[model samples]
Target: MGLLLLLPIVFVSNALVPTQRMTPWLRDLTTWNPISAVTAAARELLGNPNPAASIDAWPMQHPVHATPIWSSDY
Candidate 1:
Protein backbone atom coordinates (compact mmCIF):
# COMPACT_ATOMS: atom_id res chain seq x y z
CA MET A 1 0.00 0.00 0.00
CA GLY A 2 2.90 2.30 0.73
CA LEU A 3 4.19 1.87 -2.80
CA LEU A 4 0.75 2.75 -4.15
CA LEU A 5 0.87 6.12 -2.49
CA LEU A 6 4.57 6.78 -2.90
CA LEU A 7 5.23 5.47 -6.40
CA PRO A 8 2.82 7.78 -8.22
CA ILE A 9 4.18 10.87 -6.45
CA VAL A 10 7.76 9.90 -7.29
CA PHE A 11 7.14 8.76 -10.84
CA VAL A 12 4.68 11.51 -11.66
CA SER A 13 7.13 14.17 -10.49
CA ASN A 14 10.26 15.33 -12.30
CA ALA A 15 12.64 13.52 -9.95
CA LEU A 16 13.05 10.49 -12.22
CA VAL A 17 12.69 12.24 -15.57
CA PRO A 18 12.69 15.74 -17.01
CA THR A 19 9.32 17.44 -17.40
CA GLN A 20 10.06 18.72 -20.88
CA ARG A 21 9.74 15.25 -22.38
CA MET A 22 6.42 14.47 -20.76
CA THR A 23 3.00 15.11 -22.34
CA PRO A 24 1.49 18.54 -21.81
CA TRP A 25 -1.16 17.45 -19.30
CA LEU A 26 1.27 15.15 -17.57
CA ARG A 27 3.89 17.88 -17.56
CA ASP A 28 1.48 20.21 -15.86
CA LEU A 29 0.68 17.58 -13.25
CA THR A 30 4.36 16.85 -12.65
CA THR A 31 5.25 20.50 -12.44
CA TRP A 32 2.70 21.25 -9.73
CA ASN A 33 3.54 18.24 -7.63
CA PRO A 34 5.11 18.94 -4.25
CA ILE A 35 7.68 16.23 -4.88
CA SER A 36 8.90 18.13 -7.90
CA ALA A 37 9.14 21.31 -5.87
CA VAL A 38 11.19 19.46 -3.26
CA THR A 39 13.49 17.93 -5.88
CA ALA A 40 13.89 21.23 -7.67
CA ALA A 41 14.59 22.91 -4.35
CA ALA A 42 17.23 20.31 -3.50
CA ARG A 43 18.93 20.80 -6.82
CA GLU A 44 19.01 24.56 -6.40
CA LEU A 45 20.43 24.46 -2.87
CA LEU A 46 22.96 21.65 -3.49
CA GLY A 47 24.30 23.10 -6.72
CA ASN A 48 23.10 20.14 -8.75
CA PRO A 49 22.44 20.40 -12.45
CA ASN A 50 18.83 21.35 -13.22
CA PRO A 51 17.82 20.85 -16.82
CA ALA A 52 15.98 23.79 -18.30
CA ALA A 53 12.23 23.32 -18.19
CA SER A 54 10.43 24.13 -21.43
CA ILE A 55 7.37 25.33 -19.55
CA ASP A 56 7.49 28.07 -16.95
CA ALA A 57 5.55 26.42 -14.13
CA TRP A 58 5.63 28.53 -10.97
CA PRO A 59 6.72 25.67 -8.70
CA MET A 60 9.59 24.54 -10.89
CA GLN A 61 10.71 28.04 -11.71
CA HIS A 62 10.75 29.15 -8.08
CA PRO A 63 11.25 25.96 -6.10
CA VAL A 64 13.47 27.60 -3.52
CA HIS A 65 10.54 29.73 -2.53
CA ALA A 66 7.85 27.13 -3.26
CA THR A 67 9.25 24.44 -0.95
CA PRO A 68 8.83 26.43 2.22
CA ILE A 69 5.35 27.55 1.23
CA TRP A 70 4.26 24.00 0.46
CA SER A 71 5.53 22.84 3.85
CA SER A 72 4.23 25.74 5.86
CA ASP A 73 1.38 25.50 8.39
CA TYR A 74 -0.53 28.36 6.84
Candidate 2:
Protein backbone atom coordinates (compact mmCIF):
# COMPACT_ATOMS: atom_id res chain seq x y z
CA MET A 1 0.00 0.00 0.00
CA GLY A 2 2.79 2.36 0.92
CA LEU A 3 4.74 1.50 -2.23
CA LEU A 4 1.65 1.93 -4.33
CA LEU A 5 0.99 5.35 -2.83
CA LEU A 6 4.64 6.40 -3.02
CA LEU A 7 5.04 5.15 -6.59
CA PRO A 8 2.89 7.89 -8.06
CA ILE A 9 4.75 10.68 -6.27
CA VAL A 10 8.13 9.12 -7.13
CA PHE A 11 7.20 8.74 -10.78
CA VAL A 12 5.83 12.27 -11.00
CA SER A 13 8.94 13.83 -9.47
CA ASN A 14 12.04 14.93 -11.41
CA ALA A 15 13.85 11.84 -10.14
CA LEU A 16 13.27 9.34 -12.94
CA VAL A 17 11.79 11.36 -15.82
CA PRO A 18 12.62 14.88 -16.84
CA THR A 19 9.83 17.34 -15.93
CA GLN A 20 10.53 19.46 -19.00
CA ARG A 21 8.05 17.47 -21.09
CA MET A 22 5.19 17.67 -18.64
CA THR A 23 2.20 20.00 -18.81
CA PRO A 24 2.30 23.25 -16.88
CA TRP A 25 0.07 22.00 -14.05
CA LEU A 26 2.04 18.78 -13.73
CA ARG A 27 5.28 20.65 -13.95
CA ASP A 28 4.07 22.85 -11.12
CA LEU A 29 3.36 19.79 -9.03
CA THR A 30 6.75 18.35 -9.86
CA THR A 31 8.41 21.54 -8.76
CA TRP A 32 6.47 21.66 -5.50
CA ASN A 33 6.95 18.00 -4.69
CA PRO A 34 9.01 17.48 -1.54
CA ILE A 35 10.73 14.64 -3.31
CA SER A 36 12.02 17.05 -5.92
CA ALA A 37 13.28 19.36 -3.18
CA VAL A 38 15.04 16.49 -1.44
CA THR A 39 16.52 15.27 -4.69
CA ALA A 40 17.78 18.72 -5.58
CA ALA A 41 19.18 19.28 -2.10
CA ALA A 42 20.95 15.93 -2.20
CA ARG A 43 22.41 16.57 -5.62
CA GLU A 44 23.53 20.04 -4.65
CA LEU A 45 25.12 19.02 -1.34
CA LEU A 46 26.82 16.03 -2.97
CA GLY A 47 28.26 18.20 -5.75
CA ASN A 48 26.44 16.17 -8.39
CA PRO A 49 25.11 17.52 -11.66
CA ASN A 50 21.82 19.17 -10.79
CA PRO A 51 19.85 20.28 -13.79
CA ALA A 52 18.81 23.91 -14.01
CA ALA A 53 15.07 24.38 -14.06
CA SER A 54 13.55 27.19 -16.05
CA ILE A 55 10.40 27.20 -13.93
CA ASP A 56 11.99 28.95 -10.95
CA ALA A 57 9.64 27.45 -8.40
CA TRP A 58 10.74 27.91 -4.78
CA PRO A 59 11.45 24.28 -3.89
CA MET A 60 13.46 23.40 -6.96
CA GLN A 61 15.11 26.79 -7.06
CA HIS A 62 16.02 26.74 -3.37
CA PRO A 63 16.11 23.09 -2.43
CA VAL A 64 18.68 23.44 0.30
CA HIS A 65 16.40 25.89 2.06
CA ALA A 66 13.23 24.08 1.06
CA THR A 67 14.12 20.65 2.46
CA PRO A 68 13.78 21.62 6.10
CA ILE A 69 10.46 23.29 5.38
CA TRP A 70 9.14 20.16 3.76
CA SER A 71 10.50 17.91 6.51
CA SER A 72 8.81 19.84 9.26
CA ASP A 73 5.30 18.97 10.43
CA TYR A 74 3.35 22.00 9.66
Q: Report the CA-based lDDT of candidate 1 relative to the real structure.
A: 0.84
Model 1 regions lying over 4 Å from their true place: 1-3, 52-54
lDDT of 2 by residue, 1-74 (tens): 99999889888788877777899999888989988888888988999877734557878778999999999997
| Per-candidate local distance difference test | 0.84, 0.84
TM-scores of the candidates are 0.84, 0.84
lDDT score at residue 38, model 2, on the 0-100 scale: 87
lDDT of 1 by residue, 1-74 (tens): 99899887898888888888788899889989998999998998899977634458888888999989988996
Candidate 2 whole-model C-alpha lDDT, 0 to 1? 0.84
